[model samples]
Target: MIFAAILAGGVGNRMGEVDKPKQFLTLGDKPILIQTVEKFYLNSRIDEVIVLCHKYWLNHTKDLIEDYIPNAENIVVVEGGELRNDTIMNAVKYIEDNHELSEDDIIITHDSVRPFVTHRIIMENIEKTQEVGACDTVIPATDTIVVCHDGNIISDIPNRNYMYQGQTPQSFKILKLKECFNKLSDEDKRSLSDAAKIFVLNGEEVAIVKGEVFNIKITYPYDLKVANTIIDDAKLNISDAETGEYKVNLYDFGEE
Candidate 1:
């Protein structure tokens, strides 16, 4: 069984005075969370999608899915945890309680705000995780990466060739992820920036899947504007063969 864990646990502090979480904010015609869910929902390879939403918005998340997606039987909404990793564990707990949890089962964790994730990326994440034990999607860094240990000054400048900006659909074999996570000390667990680091800290290899430049995460007011532009450009560039209607190209890896 394969699961896609859509993390919608954020409170949107960085997004500035928003009525709701950034995931619930509109991007183009649909809410950002729905758009992201629809990507995994449309994929035939994905068995189920688990949305870990903030507890305050759990019902709203369910309502959004019910209204936006037809026959959403495979999608489930559960209350998210206090932390990102804890939220992932909540999804794991859901799978273990409701279905057969096996070592071979794969869980592909993605940002609920990253609606531009492509089919090629999703497929590659599953394939690579199956081959290697874990995988993280990333794109080559276009700018010089400056490492500043203190906010006051730049500590080091890393080689651009070696630097890559990490993106999601960070995937892993279900049992393997759980095993690695259990080994972490409580302090280490609290300091984790993302799940892939859990494997890295444990001396585990994580394969990388090439990500699209347009796979942007909508975190702030500026990002929402950029997301809208991306959607409009995709519509202008692509047209449906059958309907002769302009549509956003959400599946393909290439630029629209």
Candidate 2:
């Protein structure tokens, strides 16, 4: 089975003075989290979707269900935890408690703020996870990367060719990930960031699939502005195509 878990548990601390969480903010016509969910919801490769939303936003998520993914028996909403990994574990526990899953079953974990994840990314993750026990979506780093401590001096600069910026839809085989989590020490559990890291710290090899640059996580106010611009541009392009405003003139090249 191919399952998707979207983490929407953040409090939007960096988004400053917002009435709602960042995930609930509007990008186009729908909430950011709803847009993220719709990617998996519309994917033919996904069998089910689980949304781990903030505890305070449960009712709002339910309301979204009425408008967006209405009567979606395959979709579920559960209260998220204070920490990100806790939210993922909650979804894992939910699956274990409710249904039986195998090692071959893949669970794709994504961020709710990344509303631009495409179907191509989702399908690639599904196929890659089936080949390897775990996989992560990433893009080749275009900028120089530096390792620094205390926000002062750069300690090291890794080769750019070997570096990648990790994105979401980090997928793992059900039982394999469960086993990795079970083996985590107290220190590992406390410091771990995402499921992909789980495989890394455990000395398990994870495959990486190419990700798009537009699949950016909305972390700050600047990101929100960029998201709106991208969405508006996309809408304008579509409108231009539909209205035949985007046309080619052969007369520009010759007198034909």
Candidate 3:
């Protein structure tokens, strides 16, 4: 089974002075988290989706599902942990405790705020995970990377050709990731910021699948603005077929 885990536990501290988490913020006509869920829900290859959300917003998350996603039963909403990695582990524990996950089964972890994830990217994650034990989505870095040890001075400048900006739907085989998780000490687990790093810390090879520039994570205020622009542009390109279908449905009467 291929499962999708969306981590929405963060309070969006970087986004600053928000009443709600960044995932709950509006994107296009729907909530940002719902838009992210829709990508996985619409994908033919995904078997199930579990959203790990903040405790205070879990009820709101459920309400969003009731409103937006028609097949809401396919999604599972659960309380998330305080930390990002802890939220991921919560999903892993749920899967282990409830489901019969196999070594061949894949689990893809994504950010709930990354609403622009494509079906192709999701499929690529699954494909890469099948070949290797784990895979991380990444785009080639276009900017010069300055390694700074202090607040003011740059210690080193790395080659841009070697740097890749990581993105999500970072995927891994269920059993393999579980084994890696088991090897981690409590201190090691707390330090983890990325799911793919679990494999790296375990001395395993994590494969990379090419990701697009548009697969940006909506973290700060600037990111949200960029996402809104993307959404507006996409809305402008809505096909005539869809508009025609809407018109056809609009005129339909109730069954006699």
Candidate 4:
């Protein structure tokens, strides 16, 4: 059984004045968290989705899920811990305490702010992870990168050939990620971004699935505008079926 854990328990500091965290903020009509959750909820491959949110937002989130995504199954809203890792730890604890999850039970641990993730991206990531060990979408650097020192001259421009910007829908096999998480040191535990990083630090081969540019994380207030435009563009480009139902798989374009 495939499962997804969305880490939606953040109080946005960067997105000042938008105090309720970026996930709860409105992107036009739909909440950013709802949009993020719906992408995976609509997918047949995802069996259950456990939303990790702050203790304060837990009940509200549950109500929002009911109102927004009525068709989803096994949707659980749990109170997250103070720290990010602590929040994830709570999710891990829940999985261990409840379900008999297998190594192949795919866990797509995603950020709640990145509402631009498409159905194709989810399908592609899961498919690739099934083939290889683990995979994540990363973008190559476009501008010059610098290695800086403490207010002094440091190394000159280095090779951009291998540099990449890591994006989300960062997926893993539940058992593998659990094993990696178990081995993390306190220092590494505090510094890690996603499950992929934990695997990399353990010398495991983590594959890359190229991410689309529109799948941007909403941090600042300006990001919402970009996401709105992307959603609008997506609707415009995609067409309806013969029965007048909108084809959700835009990436399945012309694929016989």
- lDDT tens per residue, model 2, 78-139: 98887888888888888888888877888899999998887778888988999988999999
TM-score of each: 0.93, 0.92, 0.90, 0.87
Q: All models: lDDT?
A: 0.91, 0.86, 0.85, 0.79
In model 4, pairs of residues that clash are: none
TM-score of 2: 0.92
**Top candidate (lDDT):** 1
lDDT agreement of model 4 with the native: 0.79
In candidate 2, what residue range of length 10 has the lowest lDDT sum?
247-256
**Alpha-carbon deviation at 111 in model 2, angstroms:** 0.3
Q: Model 3 over residues 21-75: C-alpha lDDT tens digits?
A: 8999998788999989988987878888999998888899988988888666779
- Sorted on TM-score, best first, the list reads 1, 2, 3, 4
> Candidate 4, 233: how far from true, in Å?
3.4
| Candidate 3 Cα outliers beyond 4 Å, as residue runs | 239-256
- Residue 96, candidate 4: Cα error in Å is 2.0
User: Lowest summed lDDT over 10 consecutive residues: which window, candidate 1?
Assistant: 246-255
Select the stronger candidate by lDDT from 1 and 2: 1
